[model samples]
Target chain A: MADHEHKDNEQLGAAGFNRRGLLKCMAWAGTGVLWTVNGGVPRSLGLLGEAAAAESHAGGLTFLQISDSHVGFDKPANPNALGTFQEAIAKIKAMPTQPAFIVHTGDITHLSKDKEFDDADQAMKALKQKVHVIPGEHDVADADNGKAYLDRYGKGTQGRGWYSFDAGGVHFIALINVFNFQPGFKSAGLAQLGDEQLEWMEKDVKGLSSSTPIVVLAHLPLWTVYENWGWGTEDAPRALGYLKRFGSVTVLNGHIHQIQQKIEGNVSFHTARSTAFPQPAPGSAPAPGPMKVPAEQLHSVLGVRTVNYIRGKSPLAIVDTPLSA
Target chain B: MLRTRAVLLGGAALSAMLCAAAPAVISGGGPALAAAKAASVKIDNFNFTPPTLVVEPGTTVTWTNADDSPHSVREMDGRFKSAALDTDDSFSQTFSAPGQYQYFCSIHPRMVGKIIVQPAGKTSSN
Candidate 1:
């Protein structure tokens, strides 16, 4: 691993490129690529080698994003969802620079059973960092309409497990969009943030300065992506409208189970991969479900994301490393 | 367990009747016997097979999930709602009254279905 990291640094040095040249030549250099934003333009800094090492030592705030663990899922796609989730935890435990915390975007269980929540909790207990979680639709499937999820994780949260906090000079807001799923109630057949949560969010950021970097975390995509598959949120445009005053806003979501990113004005939206099993790309399959890939390639398609924030930097740096890589 | 066995036997009997090309006389059964008439809805590839099912009153509608994802059967008017059904899992609802009921998979709302229960003694419109 050290040799690979060294080689990556050597290639960049050999190019004898300035910052502008590096930005122009930068392709998505596979796994471990660090993405930083400057003037709302994202640049991929290939490989997490010297640059990441320096940032870690410089006291930057780094965190992990793990989503869709689906702890009770035991299907052909990936027979041991819990096992893979634990493997992701192990990877985070072994990171060279420990992250400050972890934000699990949701789907923490398959059926929202008590035992499934217990199993996922036991596995997550292995991580040294505190975890911030929002419920995926699966987590709230209990007969009581999410009472089970609220019992265990609802402390300090408001209105169906949404809350905000300040971390590393960044304002972090966790929203819940996987509710209000009664029959005939429709949000274009997609997830929704609802009126109460939207109002709370508006007041949540009222005191923040325009320069404050805001990170919005939810279980579903904040923007519409493949409406037929329910991959996007219905009222996300309204929620996003509130953040327009902020100079830098990053919305992190997880329900899609694959990485899809979009940039609009000063906002950047990113979806993370699932730790349980991969789903087909939007509109690629007959429907959106656990996508069965070649058994050998499963690990490569499933992994975690790391985000680093430096105080003076305009936007946070994001690194996505596959488990196999 | 008894309910499951009864539903299975009822399904078998229904299939046999259909195979024999007999007139569907699914009426005039006692309370115990009335619970035996079964109609099925198959959930595969995120869509309900036989999306619109018309059956005689007192027929039990069973939804079987065949896809890898989990789905729940919930009526639009909140008459009945099932827990999440994983692959091979099934949920059954007995419609005693005659009316049209709309339902959808609460997990994936895009997948919708309908059930119409006509007055007793009428053949299934299907």
Candidate 2:
């Protein structure tokens, strides 16, 4: 993708275009444009803007998203989740190109046992890259205040394990909405980002320019995919409001252990497949849980997602590759 | 004289009395057979088999996790709560108060169940 600002300027030199006219010009360019405001005026940049602009200095940024490892689970769906988890890691190891890091959305274990965490830790260590993890309900089912999870993955996170970081000119926010869930509904309970975290999130993004790409990571879906199964977050709208100003937003989650995607305006929502086992599609079964599949077909549904960031062209370019595929 | 002759010849009145008593026998000696009341709600397929149950005020209700996943029973109004129960694990609560108590699994909220406790000494018909 190429920037046409200088060429377009020559053609429209004395015309003095309005906002609508500029957008029309952007469309005419036939390329994804990243729009930013400078000095109270809107300007468009070429596809693969800043992130790719530095390809010579540092390679193009790429990250792997893996979730629902369920290390200790021993069920018919996938009797040895640990074995499949190793397969997932092997797939990452065999990738022709390496990702900068791996973000584990949640559910690193079936039960938050020390051995489970240890198995997950040893498996993830094989990748040899930084692994960022948030907790799923299963990880905290045995520990109060998430002491067990915190001891492993919650080193610098604040208030139930939510934090943000900057990588390759893109902002990534890791949130925890699985705590204090309202019980008896279904699945993971309608996810919630409490008042304290929501307040912190608003201030966190207050200083970011709208052009910066924002990636929100949590265990449960931020939007209402299926409330009856507690597959949605209750107060995600409040958290989303803080992100409205950003030009690009991508939300990633993994409690459902299926591949689901949604795009709303400038925001895109994606739930990755599990490395442990497959779950039935929403409403396809009586409820969401370990969906036993034919032994041969087990690997076809569980895998990891690789996201490539091209600056001006909507930083989130997600490609899901199953263990078999 | 005609009624006496009919009863002696066919025994129709006695048969009718036995016919009426058959249902009572099948229903386990009427509602007074308190030992046979359904007092447990089996949680399987992520649901409460009998979504609603009725029993005497002093009856104890047991919820068993028959599914392979973990679950918990929690009262909607904060009256009772259970810890995370793995497969085959069970939790029980006795309803001494005569009222409706709604509860759900904390792990799977949609799996809701209701228990109606009748007044003291009253047993629910199966």
Candidate 3:
């Protein structure tokens, strides 16, 4: 064990969380960042360490998903999103399964502020689990110059910012679709993948076997959730088409900050509830965006999803449990 | 800032996105047309501040798109639909008939809201 780990363990100062290879203090070109890795995935080491220790049991395809933390949002709905994110961590610690990996669909922070990123990283570190992420519109909202959201999260990604990885017998594809903001709406300029990304995707999937189950992680909805509010992706058809050959597919997104699920053919698309706040369901309001729920109801709406994988199971069962549930 | 406006306006239409620079003012198609009782609704991120509105019949309820995106006052469970408006574009639809008109943005169904067109000659105290 290293000096820090050995000293912290002796003093009982450390939470004894799985720090493993989580914090890779790699020296980057610009500012130095302590990049952490979990299960061969780079992650923000926040509360994940301690949280990881608490529920490091419940083995076999155990993973957690939290979306739309919206850290910088200061509104009546959630006065301090950072606080709610803590509440989410508390839940993760309480879970029976020490998930092998953690996935944050997008919108980790509201304004993509460096502080916000740090805060999210700090909180997630407690989990002590592998964390994979996609970027939501909010994260890139106030980015500087061309240092857009993708630049920060788009490491080793496709031209349009799409990337895929292999994990525990499953192929996870992180797609960027929030960029394809349609015309005549609130979205500025455009928000969608260009031709380059699409072509890469075709090539990316060509190597995978049809039997491999693919999990698509993105910020926007791959299916048409709500067009008026730009909830759905504009060029998702091509992206979805690439996955047609796959046997089982699960697409997870977070921009909507609500739970909307649909099963088409062998694919299942699910929009996760935001750990920050809950938005009204589709067609429940005059527009599509963040909807504030009452304080008491926050826990009920915010929670986690437990996905289990069996060698020869007919289909993967995804159990979404809200805090209230 | 745009999101706050949408919530404050109570789902009011946007002038920039919906009507191309023309502010969407509710149509005053009522007996008190000259004295149109104006009310504003807001659409934030993708939610209606007031998912369902209760207004007296003939009340000109204007939906303002205070958010950066365009929204419409389409009738969800009724016979009314508006074109996709851009940010700042506004749309106004006066309630001439008395019924529960569920409206939403055809472009974004999750951006759903309702207008309770009350019967004429009656006033909504609240």
Candidate 4:
């Protein structure tokens, strides 16, 4: 299996494809490849043919990630943002085996209006699985400063809607870094986890063994992607220090509206695509905003991510499938 | 400073021409009448145009969002703040004190700007 994966990597290199180019090609193809991790390294197992079979045989845990469903957005880039969000939900409903749960990493609403939140809630009700969510800057733009989002999703969460949970022997931590603009706070134009949350997180994982797999979810990229565009977190490095001892750590975030992945030691960071619209690559455009594309090519840039984990395996298999695919 | 007045005058003339019933204050107006009594900043492409503006005290500064994304104008010291402004929305704040007030978009904080308020009859050093 290792040799086969090595050959595939060599072939991709020979084709002159960088990592981002390879991901864009995979996204354009819409066939969706499956990734398997051995030790701390990840390898693609070609397409979904063998990956699907391996998933059923292992039958460990599968979960879905959908993000940036700006419900009230009506720009030229995508006039029907809510329509596309519903389409993404319909796609999830059609899957042969429903994931254990769904995690929406924020931007659930465009302007945090009551109608927008209502519309989002009604659409998400169609799915059978429960959804865990963190707030994006767009979701907390209400006049009262996040009161609307908290009233709906903050029943048991602590401090601006951050919490942790465990499923299938893997620990999951949901964080909120989009609160730099809230009253009584000052930040350097980037998302922040804050010192209070960092303290909570340090205690949250204190008792866990080093062997336990850790998964982190947040609205903005925990790692800095583009400082000029405010696409990264300010205090994430301090939070990451608390999780350094974990054997396998996977961090999932969504704010840039595109897919980006990085690996450092035992940690793998991933940003999911938005269901609403796409943004230009870092430094690719004058600034980051809704990027207008040909109507026919829109679906190729927007999609959903599915992650499967097998106990005792150090790596989680992640697959990104576009809407049209 | 001359170019800024020209652009404002041009905009005022265009608006006056578009609206036949509008007041005739902009037509044949001199430079004094077109002075920075009221200034405007445009938010477009995630940038605050006229990143630095000099105006007399009591001048009302209005920010207009032209981008499809939502943005808010917030004073760094919490002196003033505007709610989220959607496309085509406008927010105005009157600067009554002669001081420099730095602000940024609360949503996209990298987009920063400054409004320099000068005392009456005094030219702005900036």
lDDT of 1 by residue, B40-65 (tens): 99999888877777676778888999
Candidate 4 wrongly placed segments (more than 4 Å): A1-21, A27-31, A48-58, A181-188, B2-37, B123-126
lDDT of each: 0.77, 0.70, 0.59, 0.77
Chain B only: TM-score of model 4? 0.69
Better of 2 and 4 by lDDT: 4
The lDDT-based order of candidates, best leading, equals: 4, 1, 2, 3
**Isolated chain A TM-score, each model:** 0.88, 0.80, 0.76, 0.89
Q: For model 3, how does the per-residue alpha-carbon lDDT over B5-87 read when each residue is reduced to its tens digit?
A: 33444444332123223333334455657475556577767666676666665577766666644345555322444443445
Between candidates 1 and 2, which one is better according to TM-score?
1
Candidate 4, residues B1-126, lDDT tens digits: the string is: 833643443323323323434222212223544454678999998888887676776677789999989998876655677778899998887766656566787778778776766575554332
The best candidate by DockQ is 1
Ranking by DockQ: 1, 4, 2, 3
By TM-score, rank the candidates, best first: 4, 1, 2, 3
Write one digit per residue (lDDT tens) for candidate 1, span A1-325. Answer: 2233233334434222343333223212224446665544445555656465346434678888999999999999999999999999999998888889999999999998999999999999999889999999999877566889999999999987899988998899999988864333244478789999999999999888999988999998998767778777878999999999988899899988776666778887778888888887666677899988777878877788888887877557777766666
Interface RMSD of each: 2.5, 3.6, 11.3, 3.9
Give stretches of model 1 more than 4 Å off: A1-30, A49-57, A181-188, B1-34, B121-126
lDDT of 2 at B65: 86
